[model samples]
Target: MTSASVPLSGPRFQTEPAELYRELRRDHGAVVPVSLDGDIPAWLVLGYRELHQVTGDPVLFSRDPDLWNQWPGIPDDWPMLPVIGRKQSSILYTVGERHRVRAAMISDALEAVDPFELRGHAEKFADELIDAVSGKGEADLIGDYAALLPVRVLATLYGFTDEQGPGLVTALNDMLNRTADALAGKQHLAASMGQLLADRKVTPGNDVVSRMLATALALEAEGSGSGFTDEEIVQDLVVMFAAGHQPTADWMGNSLRLMLTDDRFAASLFGGRNSVAEAMNEVLWEATPSQNLVGRWASRDTQLGGRRIRTGDLLILGLQGANSDPQVRTDGSALTGGNSAHFSFGHGAHRCPFPAQEIAEIIARTGIEVVLDRLPDIDLAVPAESLPWRPSPWLRSLTELPVHFAPTPPLEATSA
Candidate 1:
């Protein structure tokens, strides 16, 4: 069949993106043709093996921003990504070694966040959420609980008041949703956070931002070759907030939605025997956040998957496809096991660092067993088919998930 004739089905599963990717691998194999706006031609790599080979070899599929700048289809004025001297993907554009130096400076701050401590925080939040939903007997878990929780945690850590976290999330979502509009939303949020960081610098508080700023200042004092500029630091702040909050929230929401449908998986996870690792792998495999292609431009003439790619060719790494490859799935089952090697987080040097660990705990701790223990009878208030799903290429989230359950009892009075 011609490339255009390849059937493009919508996302697979009630909550998994892997099945959709598996179909792509079965139909297209290594490289699939894509036609973007204006008939721009590109090749999407749909095999896990191929994506690994390309991402690991940065020399072949360079991360340099100039390639994106030179991409043919992007409009001269469009802002799908913010414009700096280089591409938004460029480390320098975000903060380069300065970012690394800042990260190092705050290493102590981050290290202070013991997983046990974070677990306490998450459990408290989850408990309160369960209590809230219990009374209604039905809750839109994604809206009523899941999405709000992580961002609140992140905001508190970052020195933002709990009230501000949701606003920041809404702003970031707006930017990401309007990505095709040339990132106007990102620019707007950048301006707002830039102001916030400057205020924090002058009137420092005991929050994550203050700690990071202290780290930045110490790095500057050491005469390091790499230190973040004020602008770069602010940009990195925006990145941290966005990167930290969204995917995990989406993963939790999706995982909960999926488990509500499958009783066996729910029983094992919430029963607490399964370590957090098992829950994480399964949820990440099931949700597959980085479901869209990672865009790269050919640095030079190269042959891949037996196809010759000339200089300036765009190569989209099919993360979703690789994660769902039948070869990657154990016995072709959706159950997370030895063969489940999905790339919900992009592979290699740039894989998501913090959220992977933190979110895994949230999912592991807030499993079917946990939910059932606290809020049994929590079934879909409406048919799964009635829920609205977000349409972004990179990730998936339910716009809403209404669920019915028992009301939580009122908290008893306690002696101080």
Candidate 2:
């Protein structure tokens, strides 16, 4: 890290990040020293090989943001507090054997989700969202469809009523965008989760929270006897809801954007489902929803990508940068499907759990399929170059994905 560190600024990081990432790699090699909003320093790991090394070794690259050496300088009202905070009890900062048990609890609860039921919920929500704007003959898919779908399914799966989904979505968006309302949003979400937990304790249901609450009681059977508390479960739920919603929503929007604009997918968009999966996979590699992750700290002084990282230094996981690392994509033609090696999901034990990944996939893919089924003639409402993306260093999402389609009738609401 040096005085010449990149300022991590500009709209280019959002609108056209690929070129920016390329330049960063060219000038600074794999791990570029960078400055955040307040000139706070960190490393952005851009090399596929280096990112693999960083994430693969949990001991060397720690997840505890408290390990950050710059923390003492961070203020009480810092904007990045939500992204990097102290005293957060979520599983994200949990370490060692405790983290392993927590991971198992999460995995077991998610794995228990009946695939048929999960898909059924996804399809239900997708159809309902599509039904909203179908009659208009045109819609901003990002707002009308993509952004509204995932969290609804997730909320329902977590025992929240259908009516509660919209409010949760609003709160989550505010929280993730890191705006003035962020703390309020976080408080709102926490309140909602608290309410749900209280309700489930009184009378459990067939949902993720109910399962987690029940399973947390059986920690001895789950590899630990100490177990966890209800507040801990609430924190985990908040993390799960935040992680699953926005990225999956963006995955749907990004994939649909790709299908609508790219000629390779245009031919099949209206006729068949053959190209849907390929387009989704391509988004994972090229325009991954999670562009970067608020990330690992150096457990000790170490050298990565030829840069000396002092103990407790922050290292943000540059997922998109790593995926597009020139060394890995030497051919540069871009991968389609059947190649799941992308860092879109993090690596090693601390990675997004497989079941959670599957849930995101189901929500995203099902939303795309529903749109194609309902709006067969969907096309970009504006020129491809005019499409706007949300400005953020962490998430890659469109501000709006406007599209026009043949007028269709809205479907009547029905029980799933």
Candidate 3:
């Protein structure tokens, strides 16, 4: 399968891909052959159970890009190089002992964040963003609100000042989108993180970076050998921004779109018949933020979901497809009732570490709820079909979410 023969990215799958997914499941079971950029063939895992099996057994299906069969032969100018290239030191690219060490460091750093305070902060950001457009009675929610909230909140948590927020957000967007500017965006991100780390070393503060640096120093003092290097710290910061900022932004956009389009959900949520939490779960089950996770390379020859996966074969988990599997639930109602058996946040060691009660869910819910609270009458400016989405295989983000709402007065104070 070559790139010219088939389309594997999210844009091709955006037009009601359920039928395609169902057909793939029927013809190929859970795992199907698909082409990524440059016609790179990979296994697309679409079954919920199969995702668990593969991600759970990381030894068989490794996260290391070095194990990919085409890594060596792939040219430097390959379009997918920015995403598939193994040039960074992210825990997302590691496995086994190395993965454990990095995961521990990240977990420890996140421990300092108070979930309740984080929720308040997220809400505050949401309100300020909304206020920027609320008085106009119309705004592009994606640009004016959804896209700004998460990055701003994350920047603050990472100890980035207001001046650095826009640059960080731009770099994150370019890097995650894998555009022509991806390499430049990566360089910008590295330089910014390097400067931040240097400053923290000299004068540490109570932010995620400072916490991580302190932890790395303590671990080095114990001669653990697992201590984080400067490069590793930078990589981890990139991962955090990539993982926390964009995905959360996508979730906000997807959830808002769902709430506006789905009559059942829109009525219930806006009418106060259903909670934001319930609506969020429903949206997550239906339109997951991360549609396909970062590809996992097969470490050795193995059979998965009745498909032959050779050593070095790339496996891309179809997160949204798996969550929509008929075997999971008949409809979104089950999701609203708290049957969150979706692979949206994934599973196994690579599962998102943000706990359900805290970080991820709280941030997303608060972001949405605050908007609804500020602009109760907000509605789509155009038909749902007119809205555009980001064209990437890994995420379900909107290009822009234009919305209109009743003009309202801004709050007296913007501080959280």
Candidate 2 lDDT over 1-416, as tens digits, reads 23379987778888779999998988899999999879999999999999999999988898888789998889998978767778578899998888888998899889888878988999988887778888889999988878778889999889999888889988987897667898898899999999998899899999999999887877745664658888899999999998889889999999999999999998767677888999999999999998988899999999999999999999999999999997889899687767998999899889999999999888888889888888868889899998888778888888899999998777773323
Ranking by lDDT: 2, 3, 1
Per-residue CA lDDT of candidate 3, range 1-416, in tens? 12122357654566666677777677667777788777778888888889889888888888888888877668878877655667467778878987877787788788778887788788877877877877889988787877777877888888888789888777877786667888898899889988999999999998889988998898899896878799988988887877787778878788888888877677644657356677678768777887877678898898987777899998888998798777775553456668777887778787777542256676788888877877858889999998887766666778898888888877754333
TM-score per prediction, in order, is 0.80, 0.95, 0.91
- By lDDT, is 1 or 3 better? 3
> All candidates' lDDT scores?
0.61, 0.88, 0.78
Model 2, position 212, has a per-residue lDDT of: 91
Model 1: how far is 62 from its true place, Å? 2.3
Q: Please estimate how well model 1 matches the true structure, expressed as its whole-model Cα lDDT.
A: 0.61
Angstrom error at residue 158, model 1: 1.0
In the predicted model 3, the residue pairs found to clash are 3-39
lDDT leader: 2
